[model samples]
Target chain A: MATVEYRNITKRFESFEVMRDLSLSIADGEFAVLLGASGCGKTTLLRMTAGLETVTAGDLLIDGLRVNEVPPRDRDIAMVFQNYALYPTMTVAENIAFSLEIRRVPKAERRRRAEEAAALVGLGEHLARYPRELSGGQRQRVAMARAMVREAKVFLFDEPLSNLDAKLRAQMRFEIRQLHDRLGTTTIYVTHDQIEAMTMADKIVLMRGGTIEQVGTPDELYDRPVSRFAADFIGSPAMNFVEGTVEANGNAPAFVAEGIHLALPVSLTVAPGSPVVCGIRPPDLVLNADGSIEGRLVLAEKTGPDVQLHLSVAGQDFIATASRDAAVEAGGLVRLSVAPDKLHLFDPQSGRRL
Target chain B: MTVHSASRRRLRIVAAWSVVALFVFPLYYWITTAFKNARDIFDQPPSVWAFDPTLKNFEEVFGISLGFLRQQEVLPGGGNFYMAPRLWDSIVVAFGSTVLSVTLATLAAYALSRFPFRGRHAFVAWVLSTRMMPPVAVAIPLFFIYKDVGLLDTYAGVILIHAVMNLPLAVLLMKSFFDDVPKEIDESAIIDGASRWLIFRRVVLPMAKGGIAATAVLCFIFSWTEFVFVLTLTQTGLKTVPVVSSSFVTSTGTAWGNMAALGVAAMVPAFVFILLVQKQLVRGLTLGSLKQ
Candidate 1:
């Protein structure tokens, strides 16, 4: 296991800059995920760490050694690609033993270690099968076994589970996390799926436009987002935003929109009448008989355990997850209550939390 | 299923057979001519069938008549009709050229496929453009060069020209085949501690094996049938089947039977090569499609 650090990494393709001044650190044995949408340079960052892509203007360190000029073969890392990339010409056993073969490991020992890695991924019975003969999940397992057999210093995953089905994705997520816990290899997984980031990362590095938006524990990002983008990107059903202005109701601060009013905490010292945006998560809003915030119900979507209440408050669309038993109608008034401090205030112009 | 559809299907089957017959009739006539006597070859209303078959032409061309059949005469080009050494020359030239062309093309094509060099597309187009020139124009210049180098009538001289002639087409085909294999497999191998050369040899090359076989077959066929370079460059030291086939048309009445006999004999090696790699030719075309 080794620490991976990117210092002032910049990437450009013929002057079209994809990243600028991007820096982050992944600690030894830490499962840090690079989370972002497509074309956000998350994959590029992961590739640079893997030595597949060059860092245009930065120093990349593995175990504190500068690797900007190192070739990928000498970097002591293993990767699982988005498509599983199992060598089509080889059987599972041969694919797993490829690293050992390249390093001149003994034939008997290579077979033994290959079997061990295959057993770890539940692919022991498929050692002789070619990749084309296997199902998607089995092919993914072979890919994992290939990576695991190397016992390299770092493990990089480029959205390895993105090609699997929904149910298989969840299972692979749990298995991958368990494997990391057991081996404790420094891993940098790039993915666009927030659920994978939140569920598997010890540290989630949320990137936007090639810059680090936030880097912290998943809970830290979800519980106390530092920006409006972070709050919306990290949650299910997304955070609801209602544009308005801050006003003072006596000593208590309140967010006043066109047809709605939300009381804010007294300690929120926004210049009494400045423009602001109020954000709250769907689950944080409770359906009650008495509430200070009122909205017109647009639609009620039932998702078995809970219903996502689609409401229009102050002519702004919002969603609140309420229990299925809550009496809600499509075209009726819905009163939603939220703790005063549960609401987040952001600067309307910069989208920064206030 | 329906009456009209059944009749239409029958009509299509007949049409396909007619086209196939148009293709195969040359082979049928050539093989029959190899066994026909000289008079029968030039018979009025040329004998498609019912002609008495003889091994006299084969004996005249191969210089080896079975004891049962022994009717022969002086060859039009020379005193004796022995031409086995010429067939040997053709074999060496075609096989040697195929090996040389395939080896050079594979390495060049791999670099073309993977490297991000400036003007790469233009370079590929330039390579293909060399093939558009008429072979005779290149052949005359090559003859003068071979004379200076003292390579005329040598197997190496002929093999070199054939290989050079085949290179442009071979490289283009091999490049397309290399492009079919996914680039991710190479990256995965590299990250697993494999050097670039190792990834190419152990991984990518095997994946493109079928494509290589297909390419080798094409090169072999081209070298086998080539005519102008051999005719322009060689004196009496060596001659390939195509050039030597013309020798049968000297002062004597055209030896159609002898020429047809050589044609029939020449088809064996090329036919055997196709039979050997036909499976790979089919597989290579479809190999890269499954991965992604």
Candidate 2:
């Protein structure tokens, strides 16, 4: 296992910069995820680490050695691509044994190691099958076996579960995490799905516009997002934002919007009339008859054990989740309450958290 | 519903067979002329049937005197009608040139498919443009070059010219085949600690086997049927079937029977090559349409 470091890395394609001055440090045996939307350059960063794409500016260190000019072969990293990228012409056994073969391991040893890796991925019976003969999830397992056989310094995954069906994707996600836990290899996984990041990442590096917005543990990002983007991006049903001006009512601070008034914490030091965006997560918003804010319920969706309500509060849309037994209906009036400590305040002008 | 569809399919089959028959008529007439004697070949209204078959034309073409064969007067070119050696020459040149061209084209096409260099599109276009020039335009200049290099009338000379003539088409065909292979395989191989050459040989090349076989067949056929370069470059030392067939057109009259005999014999090697790779040829043509 190795630690990965990106120091001021920048990538540009003829002045159109995809990644700009990005830096990150992945600890040894850490499963760090690069999470973002499409075109957010998470895949580019992963590729740069794999030497598939050049860093364009800064140094990339693997195990504390600068690997800026090292080719992928010499870098000693194995990647599982989004398409699985299994060799179509090769059998599953050959595909797993390929890296060992290239390293000049003996034929008997190669076959032994291939079988071991295949069994690790539950593919022992499919050693002779070609990639096209397998289902999408099976192909993904073959890709995992190929990477596992390498026993490389780092394992890179570029949306490895994207092609599988939803149920399969969830199943494979747990399997991948278990494999990572067992192997303890430094892995950098790039994915747009926040659930994958939240569930699998030891450290989630939330990215937007080619730069890291926040890099923290899953709980850290969920409980304390540093910006409005992170707050909205990291949770199910997303975080709710209500725009209002902060007012100092003597020693107490209150947020006043069009038709909502919510009390802020006393320690929040903001100008009396400055505009701020108050963020509250969906689950933190409770329906209470004695609440300070009222909204019209637009819709209610029952998903499993929780019910999600889409509401329009203070001229802004918000989503709040309650228990399945909560009495909620579309087009009904509801009073929502958020604890003062659970409120996240950001500047209305810059979107940075205060 | 089944009956309507079955009748439509039957009508389609009839139309397809009619078109096939229209295309095969010339080859049918030519093969039949190979078995016809000079008298029947010159008969008015061209005997389609009821002509007496003779082995005399085959005997003359192959220089083999079967006990039942009727011998004819030897032609004026000192029995050059013995075309077995010429047939051998055609096979050697066509096979040699196909091997040469396919090897070179595969390497060049792989580079074109993978590496992104400046002017790569223009380079491919230029390679294709080389095929647009008429062979006659190049034949004279190549004749002098071959003469200076002491390569005239040599098998090597003819093979080299034919390989060069087929290179553009071979490269274009091979490039499309290489393009069908995903680039991820190459990157994966590299990450698997394989060198670039190893990836090409062990990964990409094997995946492209069907395509290469298809390309080789096309190159072999083009080299087999090529006329101008072989005619202008070779003399008595060597001649392919296409050029040697011209020698049958003499001062007195054209030996249509002898020419037809040579033409029929030449089709066998090419036909055999195509048959060997017919499965791969069909599959290779329709590749890249489906994701694996």
Q: What is the lDDT of residue B125 in candidate 1?
A: 96
lDDT of 2 by residue, A253-297 (tens): 998888888898999988889989989999999999999879899
Instruction: Score every model by TM-score.
Output: 0.94, 0.93
Best by DockQ: 1
**Model 1 - which docking category?**
medium
In model 1, residue pairs whose N, Cα or C atoms come closer than 3 Å (at least 3 residues apart or on different chains), thus clashing, are none
**Each model's lDDT:** 0.89, 0.89
Off by over 4 Å in 1: B1-12, B42-46, B67-85, B251-253, B284-291
What is candidate 2's local distance difference test score?
0.89
